[model samples]
Target chain A: MIGVLLLTIRELRAKKIILGLFGVATLVWVVLALALRLDVIEGSLAGARLFGEEMSGDSDLTDELGEPALGNSLLETFVFGAEMFAAGAAYWVGILLALFATGGLIASMLQQGQVDLLLTKPLSRSKILAGRLLGVSVVMLALLTYLLGAVWLVMSIKTGIWNPRFLLAISVVFVMFMVLYSLISLTSVWTGSTPLSLILTFGLLFASLILAIKPLHEQITQPGRSIVVGLYNILPKFVDVGAHIVPQLVVGETVESWFPFVSSLAFGVVAYALAFRLFQRKDF
Target chain B: MPASAISVKGLSKTYNSAFGKQEVHALRPLDLTVNEGEIFGLLGPNGAGKTTLVKLLLGIVHPTEGSGELFGISIRSPEARKAVGFLPENHRFPEFLTGRETLDLYARMSGTTDMDRANKSEELLERVRLTGSAHRRVKTYSKGMMQRLGIAQALMSNPKLVFLDEPTDGVDPVGRREIRDLLLELKAEGVTLFLNSHLLSEIERVCTRVAILKEGRLVREGTVEELTTQDRIWRLRSTPIPDQSLGDHAHLVSDAQSNGLSEYRLHAADRTALNASLDHLRLAGVEIESVEPLRQSLEELFIDVVEDAST
Candidate 1:
């Protein structure tokens, strides 16, 4: 397993997925660093927004909306906004890129000439497949860490605000990828087609995001609710999980209990189990 | 002591295709034993179950019926493959890895570690004449180079038995000779080799034993000399043919006056009679050039076996 992991790591590195992820992160960070400026001028929170080096607006806390703020504090607003962008734009784009990049690991590995070499090894097929999954998981985690960490750093360095809560997106995004990537692997194993795997996994992710609405959950009848609940139980709640991190980062408040994490983990375990079972029995 | 490095009894494989609408019997129930430390060649036409047999031995594909043992271990057990290495036909290695890295990866897969993996990888790369290109990515390698690297990968573990399918398929003549020499070196170390190839001449030169598989069954199996040799036939080429060709002891295979020399294929009842006929030729004052036992080339034997099975 370690040997397989080591080779997988080499494969990811050589394929330039790692470098490409870092490049996207760096580009995002540079843009964020230039556009937003947060400062404490004369004991009042002031923010300067720039549009291509031209100051678009200068807002002092008392001057922007009213004398007294009604909703979130300036610090909460800044942190919340940064985390949301990270989740909405950075995280979503990263997942799409990962779908395009890492989706082929299983499909390509299972090709006739390719699988024959690995299957003939002294290890069981399950271990080989698990190693591949864990390898991609590790790469996804590294990419998430770099992209999230860069955003956190730029936010802190530019705005002089450091919220450790933003770092939680790293784990949340990783879990989200795990849940979706499991289906990716399962589909790849079944079809042995990378394009089909990508389409199915991406479609499932989009569907999950739409179904995560609380209003949508409330409107469904008993049987409809049962089917929706069954799907929610097995698939990751992408929008819920991604959007949930914003409020958590802002108020440091926990929401939605442990159901989301448990269900996603269950989804991953079930998908992986199904994939392993099918892969073991596959003729190669 | 174990009798064979590889032993299979009534092993078979049948797969369903077209959504299980059709049954394809890839291999029929067959028994085979490859004795220890001999180069055994599996010769056949395309789709002749040669690769299927190798896959069955490696446990890459499950056998529908019967069992196989590698070095006394059940083929169904992973431990049976612990000391076994295989190079499948039209194999594709991880193209991103360099030649050395590829060997190291495959060596590590066989459970080699640390210093041993490094040493064995370097040794194999050099053995396959890829020492200079060890650091080059496999994507940069030519087809022949990839084939050599495949050889290095198979030998990484210093496996006791190695199955090579089309070991020199895309290799040039020089590379083929080098691969042949490498196989001989492996044999010298007492490694049992199961070679599957359509290259009859290559198999003829190196294989101590050969099996001809037609369709899904083993039609013939024996030593190369045994399979190619035809009994009761002698090829004679000599000058100045006698009008009556050694009486009825010999029969002409072709016209005697076709060339300056007359060629005759003689079928004598025994060695005594064959020597007597040769002695008669000499006494008749016909200048004798050469007399040799008639034998079929591996190609001829393979074609005959497959054609016979088809008919």
Candidate 2:
């Protein structure tokens, strides 16, 4: 199992896109660290600058109507906006690049010549796949922590505003990445084609976006509406989680709903279970 | 009696085609036993289930029916493979790893300790003569280099039983000779070797027992000599048989050579008839030099078995 883990790690490390991801992560925080300037006198953010331009410090957190919203000072608002942007970027681009980078691993692992050698090892089938998954998770988690953690640290240090809930975004992004990756694993095991697995994973993700439209339920007829709602309940709610859950977590607000996250977690569990079962029964 | 290294009873595999179109019987129910400290060779044409049998023993694929055991442990259990090493044909190693790294990883996966890994990796590397390229990534390796490295990797565990499939398939003549010598050395160390190879001559030279599979059925199984020996036929090297002794039983295969010895084939019915022919030749003033049973090559026997099965 340790040997398999090391091999998986080595394989992932050899793909330089992952290295480029780390570079992109480092650049994100370094640029943010250098580009933003803040003046904190007596723990109050009296002034802030973007690049070289000055910013007003008295603006209120705005609502959907662009009106000044109630509660939370201007300094807290800046912190919230910055953390939300970082988390959102981590959610979208981070997960996409991660999928592109590691999508083929499961498929490659199942290739005839490769799987033949692996299955002959002294370990059980479950252990082999577990080691491989653990390796991918370890790398992706580290990348997430590096990118999100550094951004959080830079913004917190610059403005003297500490929002610990922003750190939860790391896990949110990581969980979502893993949730989508479960689809990749399942599809790869079923089809043994990396491209096809990746395509279907992205396709599921796209369908989730369409299903997230709550108004579509009323627009459709009886059976179609029932089917839409059924799919919405079944498929991962990437859009809803991104829109509602991730932002709330970033800004240290109470979660409006746990249904999206929970349902996605359930989807991941089923997908991974199916993948392992298929792999075990596969003839290789 | 020698311990059974591998025993299979009624083992078989059937693959269902995609969408339930048709089912392919990959292997017929068969029983086989390989004893300790002997080289067993399996031969067959394409789709003859040679790979299927090896895979079933290694637990790479499950058996559709029947059971198998390795050293008293069922092959269905992971423990059955603890002392087994396999070098699958067209095997792929992690291309990112160096040759030494690949061996160390695979050995560790096989449950070898750190010290044993170090010692075995070094010794096997040197044995396969890959010491210079041991630190180079496997992606840079040539086909023959990969094969040698694979052989070294398979032996890193010092397995009690080893399965080598087409070990010398892509190797040059010299490399093939080296692999054959290495296999012989392993057999001398009291290891059981199960070889699946297309090179019949190699099997004839190294195998103690051979089995030929045709269409997933065991058509023939025996010692190399037993399977190849032509019954009721004997080769006689002697002074030329006189014309009178040249009846149906005894005839000159070739004329006498410079050394005053001729080769004759005697088709005797049995031991009594064979002794009668030798006595008749001797009485006719023909000097008897030697008599030995005639046999076909393993290649010819394998072809006959496969062709006969198809018919």
List fnat per candidate, in order: 0.72, 0.78
Best by TM-score: 2
Evaluated on chain B only, what are the TM-scores of all the candidate structures, in order?
0.91, 0.98
* Residue-level lDDT for A205 in candidate 1: 81
Q: Residues B1-311, candidate 1, lDDT per residue (tens digit)?
A: 54699999999999998699999999999999999999999988888888899998997888999999999899988889888888888999888888988888878888887889888887888888999999998989999999999988998887999999999989999999999999999999999999998889999999999998878899999999999988888898887657775677676666556666778887787799888888888888877778888999999988888888999
Look at candidate 2 and give me any clashing residue pairs: none
Tell me each candidate's RMSD, in Å, in order: 4.4, 1.8
The most accurate candidate by lDDT is 2
lDDT of 2 by residue, B222-253 (tens): 99999999999999999988787798887678
Each candidate's lDDT (Cα)? Answer: 0.82, 0.91
Per-residue CA lDDT of candidate 2, range A94-190, in tens? 8989999999999899887788778888889999999899999999999999999999999988888888889999999999999999999999989
Per-prediction TM-score: 0.87, 0.97
